[model samples]
Target: MLGAKRETVSRIISQFKKAGIIVHENGNLVVLKMDDLKEKAQ
Candidate 1:
């Protein structure tokens, strides 16, 4: 649990998915672009 509201988490996940930085596959989250993800973290 991220400790945030479910809606907030879902929104962020959607953003990441749209950005092609992550994906939801078979009920699991997969990071498609690790470098991009790290960049976003900064």
Candidate 2:
């Protein structure tokens, strides 16, 4: 597991969700579409 702060991880997950980059399911973070996420990153 990543040794990041809970608040930091929560913020990151929220941001990613809002950006359509990821989804939360069953207490897990899933990458919805890697290609789209990668495109947005660049």
Give Cα distance to truth, residue 21, candidate 2, Å.
0.6
Worst 10 residues of 1 by lDDT: 26-35
lDDT of 2 by residue, 1-42 (tens): 235466765687688788976755623434334334446766
lDDT of each: 0.58, 0.57
Off by over 4 Å in 1: 30-42
Pairs of residues at least 3 apart in sequence or in different chains that clash in candidate 2:
none
How does candidate 2 fare on TM-score? 0.47
Which candidate has the top score in lDDT?
1
